[model samples]
Target: MTSEVSRRDFLKASAAGAGFVLTFRIAGGATSAAEAAGAWEPNTVFTIDPSGIITVHITKAEMGQGVGTALAQIVAEELEADWRDIRIDYPTSDPKYGLMLTGGSWSVNWTFDALSRAGAGARHLLIEAAAKHMNEPASECIAEGNRVRHLPSGKFLTYGDIVSKGLITATLSDEELKKIQLKKPAEYKVIGKWIQRLDVPEKTNGRAKFGIDRFLPGMVYAKVIYPPTRTGSKVVSVDDSEARKVKGYISTVREGDIVAVVAENYLAAVAAQGKMRVTWDKGPHANVTTDSITQDYWNKAKNDTSAPSWVDVGDADGALAKSMKTHEAAFWTDYVGHAPLEPMNCVARYQDGTFDFFSGSQFQTRAMGDLSKLFGVKPEQIRVHQQYLGGGFGRRLEPDVMLEAGLIAKAVGKPVKLIRSREDDIARDFYRSCTLQVLKGGIDSSGAVIAWKNTLVCAYPGERYGGLDKQGRDQFSLNGSDHYYDIPNQFVRAIRAETGMEVGYVRAVAPNYTFFAVETFVD
Candidate 1:
C-alpha cells in the first residue's frame, strides 16, 4: 500500500524546538495508513532547531549494522548540510512511521528515495526562507556549507541565522517534493565521503545503552522456566517453598506453559529459580529431535509429490535419462539458533490497562500489535522505547521476550525486567528450520550443462506467520534453488514437512543454505 505523510503531520514547528520539523510518511511494504496509524505527536524524520543542528530520527533498529550512519548520509547529501552539523537519533516505535523494522537488507533500499526527498524538501524551504531574509530572489541562491548564498552579492545566511530570525515553516505536497531536484551522483559531497560513525564514540566509551543496560527504578528481576519442547507443553505444578527461603525471592508466576521466578535482584532471581521445583506436561513434540526432523525432511523430499514446482522448463527427467554423465547429491542443514550476544531481555510495565516496553526490536509495529491483542487494549496504549541491541541477527524480530515480560509484570502487579540466561535463550529460540535438498544434473558429451532438477523439503517457517502463497511455498525457504543459468531442461520443487516445531527468519535466511546446495551441486 502507498501512503504519504499528511501536510499537518509532515511539516510543522516543533513545540519544544521552536524550529521547523520535516517528516516523510513513506510506504512500508504491505502496511497501509488505516491499518497501523498511531499517535503522531512530534512525528518527524528530522528537525532543524534555531541552532541549525539537524537531528535525524531513524525508525529502524540499530543492531550493529551501522544503518544509522548510512541513512544519515543519505539525508545530509540531499540537504547539502554540513556533515558536522548532522546528528543521529533513534526514535521510539510509532505507527505513523509504518512497519518499523530492520531486516531483509531493506534499511537503505526502502528508505533511500524517501529520505532523499525529505532532505530535498527541507532544503527547498530553507533556501526560500534565507532568500526572503536576504531580500534576494530564491532562484539565484544556492545551498552549501549549511547556508544559502546569493551568487551575485556573495552574501549568505547560515541555516541557524535564518531560523533564529523566525523563518517560516512550510509543507511540501508529495507532488511538490517529487518535483524538487535531487543531487546527481557526481554532485554527492557527504554520501561517499569518509566520516566518523555517530554511534562509535558512545559505544567505545561505554556510554551506549543496549536493552541489557536498562535499569528501571522500583523494578524487579524475573527469569522464566522453559518447557522441554517447542510446542504443546503445560505447567502442571510449581513448588516454590524452597525458593521462598532465598534472601530476596518474591514469588513464582505461571502463565500457561511459562513459569517465572521473581526476586528483588537478578542474582536472587536466578538462585531462587534454581531452587523452585516445576513439572511440565511436554506435549506432542516431546519426542521431536533434530535427527527426527532431518529424517522427516529427507522422507518428504523422497516421497512427497504434493509439492508445487517453483520452476519447470523443458523435460528434465528425459534429459537426465538420456545423458551419459549425470550427478546426484543431497544436502542437509540442521536447525540453527540466533545466539545473539545479549540474550533475550525486556523491561515491561503494565498498569491500569497501559503497557510500556523498553527493549530493542526489529519488528516494533508488529510487536505493538501483538501486545495490544494480548492486553485487550488499543495500540495507542502501548509504547515501545527503542534501545540499542547488542546484536539482533534476525533474532530480535520476534517479540516473545517482550510478551513474557508483559505477562510477568501484569501477574506480579509491578514493573518487571525479564532476562533470559544464555541457556534459556538458546533452548527457547525460534531456530532456523532444518532443510534437505536433493539435486540432480546432467552434462552433454561436450561437457555442456544440459539438465537440472532440485527438490527441497522443510517445515515452512512462513506457515507460522502466513508467509506462504496459495501453492504453499515459502520463497524464504527456496530462494536460490531456481538457478539463473539457462538450462534448457530444469525443474525445482518444494515440499512441506510437518515437523511440529516453529521456525524463524535467520540472517540471510534461506539463501544461506540454498546457495550452498546449488553451488556445491554445480561444482
Candidate 2:
C-alpha cells in the first residue's frame, strides 16, 4: 500500500511554537474524508515548534536494531535540522502510522526513502517562507543549520524568526509531492555517518521501558496458569480458595485454558498463582513428544515421495542414474525457541468498549487487529502504546500476551498487567519447526555436478498462522531450497510431518535450517 503526507492543512500555530504537521494520506484503502473528519488525526513524522524544539514521531519498535537512530538520521539528513535538537518518541497505534512491523530487518530498508522525503518537504517549505520574508529568489536560498541563507546577500533567518514573523501555510498536491526531488547519496550528511543511538543512554542508565516494565495507574499484576499443552487444552476446573487466602490476592480468572491469578503486586501475584489449583483436559497433543516428532520427520524424509515438488528442473532421477559418481546425505535439526531476554508481558485496560494496550510488539498493526477481534470492537477503539523490546528475535511478533492481558482485564473489570514467567514463555512458545532434509547429487567424470535432488520433511508453520498459499505450499517451510545454480537436472520436494505442535518464525525462519542443509551437502 502507498501513502503520502497531505500538505493541504500543513502549517499550524502551536502553543509551544509555530508547528508544521505532515498529514499522511493513504492512497487506496483510506477512509473517506467525511468519515475521517472527526475521528482521524493526521499522522506526522516530525513537528518543529517556535522554540526550535523538533519532535520526531518514530513509528517502528526499538528491538536493539538501531531503527530509531537510523530513522532519525534519515529525517535530519534532509530536514537540515541539528540532530541534537531532535527528540524521538514512539507513536500510538494508528492507521496513519502505516505498517508498524519490525521483523525481517525491514524497518530501515522500507522507511528510508519515505522519511527522507518528509524531511526534504519540510526543508523546502522552510526555505520558501524564508525566501519570501527576505524578498529574495527562492532558488538562491539554501536551508542549513535550522536557518535559510541567501548565497549572494549572505543574509539568513532562523526557523524561529520566520515562524514568529508570520506563518506561511502551503499544501502540495499528490502530483507535486511525487515530483519532489530527493538528495543523492553524495549529498547525505547524517545517513552514512555514525551517530550515537538515541536509546543507548536510556538503556545504559536503566531508564528504558520494556513490556515487562509497563505499569499503569490502578493496574494489578497477574500471572497465567497455562496448560502443559499450549494448544487444544481446556480448563476442567479451578480451585482458587487457597489462592484467595494469599496476601494481596484479588481474584482468580479462568477462561478457556488460561487461569490467571491477580494480586496487588508482582510478588503477590506469583504467590497466589502457585496456590491456585487448576485441572486441564490436555487434548490430542498431550502424547506428542520431541523424540516422536524427530523420528516421524526422519521417516517422512526417507519415504514420503507423495509430497509436492517445490522445484523441479529436467529429470533428476535419469541424470543421477547415468552419472558415475553420486553422493547422498541426510541432516536433522531440532526445534528451537527465540529465547528473548524478557519474557512475554502486556498491560491492558478494558473499559466501556475501549481497550488500551501497552507492550513492545513487533507487529503492532496486526496485534491491534487481533485485539479488536477478541474484544469485538473497531480497530480504532484499541490503542496500542509501543515501548522498547528487551529482545524480539521474532517472538514479540505474536499477540498472545496482549490478548491474555486484555481478557484478564475484561474479566476482572479493572486494569491488568500480565507477566509470563520464564517457564511460561518457553513452554507456550510457537517454536521453530524441526526439520529433516536429504540431499543427493550426481557428479560427472569431469568432477562437475550434473544432477541434484533435495527432500525436506518438517512441521508446517503455515498451519499455525494463515494456511498455505494458493499454490498449496508453505513457502516458509521450504525456503532457501531453491538454488540459484545452473543445474540442468534438479528436484526439490517437501513433506509436512504432523508434529502436533505449533511452528513459527524464529530469526531468519526456515531459511536458517534450509541453507545449512544445502551448504553442508555441497561441501
Best by lDDT: 1
In candidate 2, what residue range of length 10 has the lowest lDDT sum?
A: 9-18
Query: Which one is best on TM-score?
Result: 1
| Model 1 accuracy (lDDT, Cα) | 0.79
Q: Write the per-residue lDDT of candidate 2 for residues 1-523, one digit (tens) a residue.
A: 1112111211111121212234543322325442132221113677665556566778778989888888888888888988777778897788666556676666676666667767877777778878988899999999988789999999998765664554445545546655789989998888899789999999999999887788888999999887878578788899998999999999888776678999999999999989988888888888888777777777788787788999999999999998889999998888889889988889999988889889998877667666787667888888989989888988887888888899899999889998888988898887888788899999898888899999988766654344565556777778898977788899999787766666778877345899989999889
- Candidate 2 residue spans exceeding 4 A from truth: 1-43, 163-166, 462-467
lDDT of 1 by residue, 198-310 (tens): 99999999999999989888899998877777778888888899999999999899887778999999999999989988888887888888777777777788888878999
Clashes of 1: 0
What's the residue-level lDDT of 397 in candidate 2?
Answer: 78
